[model samples]
Target chain A: MDIKEFVAQSIGQWRSQRSAHHLAFGHFEAIRSEIAIEVVADHDPAVIELCKAHDIDPGSAVAPFRMRWEGQSDWDEEEEVKGTCILVPVPDPGQANRGKLLRDRGYAETMAAAGDYYLTADGTFVLTTAYDRAAAEEKIWFINPNVRCRVSLIKTSAGSGVVTASFSSEIRQEIRQEIRQAS
Target chain B: MDIKEFVAQSIGQWRSQRSAHHLAFGHFEAIRSEIAIEVVADHDPAVIELCKAHDIDPGSAVAPFRMRWEGQSDWDEEEEVKGTCILVPVPDPGQANRGKLLRDRGYAETMAAAGDYYLTADGTFVLTTAYDRAAAEEKIWFINPNVRCRVSLIKTSAGSGVVTASFSSEIRQEIRQEIRQAS
Candidate 1:
């Protein structure tokens, strides 16, 4: 517990509040790399062998990795696009200061809410925001991990009422998976 | 400013702190059927009539409506392959809320660094967190929107910064595109 008492007891301030609660919106350099290491420190086999320096399959990649080209058609211009997103998170010690204080007060009340929420991508943690990336990658390859969450939203559609969304859901923690890949 | 005093002084229960904020976390059948309104109204032409209910080209979907979603995925369980992201402001919005209270304690410290931050979409502000849909979308698009953050890496082999984690992050509204819908 040294590295300055684990950066004075929060390892780079809880890995920058769990990398600012998973890039708090989108594309913060694909997840990161200006070199700040110790991102929650996962199981620590040297942080899962330095997340293999960056293929990041913390078992089957999708715990706290994150990615998005934003389906580039000029994905709103982060230099027109190249590719980036790493964000590793595990070795929880104040879990990045409580995931950057619950996503900056839940993103300023959805920036005053009306018609903004609708992100898409899936291979884990449930999904279906739509545009149908092959039915959201076949529900991210049969995912269930006991109903934890990364993405799942409907938010008021109404033929019979719809408004869903999820994340860690206050520690019910079931999220199971088994995928293997190591060299 | 009527609707029950605009939900009493503009829906003042969201209590993360505010100076100019808005909200959305999901499971939003309009949050028990919309009532609160006015942390700054007029911006809600119903988010430009739901961007005219996605006719597309609202200048590239307004960068997914300004970005915010953190699903946290076990494949997202029944929520399913859920992923979403869009967080702008590497820096901006100032005076006194101190980067909106360090992005409101870094959005509950990125949902307690991805433990559980759920809702599953409704009127919108969707999340749940562990880091999948691109690290649950870097917990709001690469933090420090107030603070807490990760990723600095600078392209290595091709793996550079491998990513495929997703959960959820859907937020939009930073202004700048009103070219009357890019003309």
Candidate 2:
């Protein structure tokens, strides 16, 4: 599918179960989360504000997304971690599946991030982001229209030019309605 | 280039510089390393041993590799970190650029890893591995015959199914001779 259609299809509720691996510490964890993705109109106030914050032209953005995640991890049993982000995809003229992914909050909440997104010929969605001191790349693909899978790679470093830790995750996703109604 | 050509071309000493980004911890570090890749003959003792260890017939392995890495990082200043591993690629019958990657020492040395390797239509080399508690996927491609780049994603999980950390890295490589002579 083309980039536009792919983005449009992603507007829905998804429940995901992910298995994460911490390479440096030799540990693993199971995580479950629910994600809600909604499309924001180009002229919406939030989109406008995001564009202004990132110095992006509102007209150039093909799609703006508001994503919310609510989940609990094994490490923190009592609290459900929650986060929300606005993602804006700006135009990339010459490349297929290549564009800017602008986010309201990056690796750290205090910073904004502008990253790259690409859709491969085989329908794999790749997103890469670089922060002041951190960077990440995530790849997502659909096993079917209702089932999605993701792989993420994250790294952190100390000031003295050494990698302090590395982590990776494998996530499986299904439509929330299908999962709920089946049960 | 075809898979055979690609593998043959990779025989050389390489100097690499990598920037690792940690997502959850919000840090970045620079790492420098040198690698030497040599082809292991089909009848080599190491290849034979690896095939025996992995329970594969020696004749099925397309190529066996001996790779050594020597590097230093910020976390440890005085001592150099070093490792060596044997990578054996078994025949892939049905898919193009797809095969099994059998490694003597994976991620942390505690587990042996059997992974999949695929060469994309665009010539990107992709490797994916799953251990009992950790998983990783890495992509490598050559900008030209002499310049190569790689991106890696590693994840570790606990038995209870929670992901504690994620790590990602971007590495650039050049022929060791050129790098050394220029320096």
- lDDT of candidate 1 over A1-183, digit per residue (tens): 212222222212110001112122222211211112233433545435545654445553223322222112212334432233333332324332111100101121221111111223332222222221111111111122221122222322221111222222111111111111210
**How much lDDT does each candidate structure score?**
0.22, 0.63
lDDT of 2 by residue, B42-106 (tens): 89888888889888998888768888889875555687868888888885876547888888888
| Structural similarity to truth (TM-score) of each candidate | 0.19, 0.54
Q: Write the per-residue lDDT of candidate 1 for residues B1-183, one digit (tens) a residue.
A: 112221122221111100100101111110110111124232434344433443322232211122223232222234522222222111112221111001111232232121222212221122332322222222322111211111111111232122222232222222112211432
lDDT of 1 at B112: 18
DockQ of each: 0.03, 0.07
Listed per model, the TM-scores of chain A against the true chain A are 0.19, 0.82
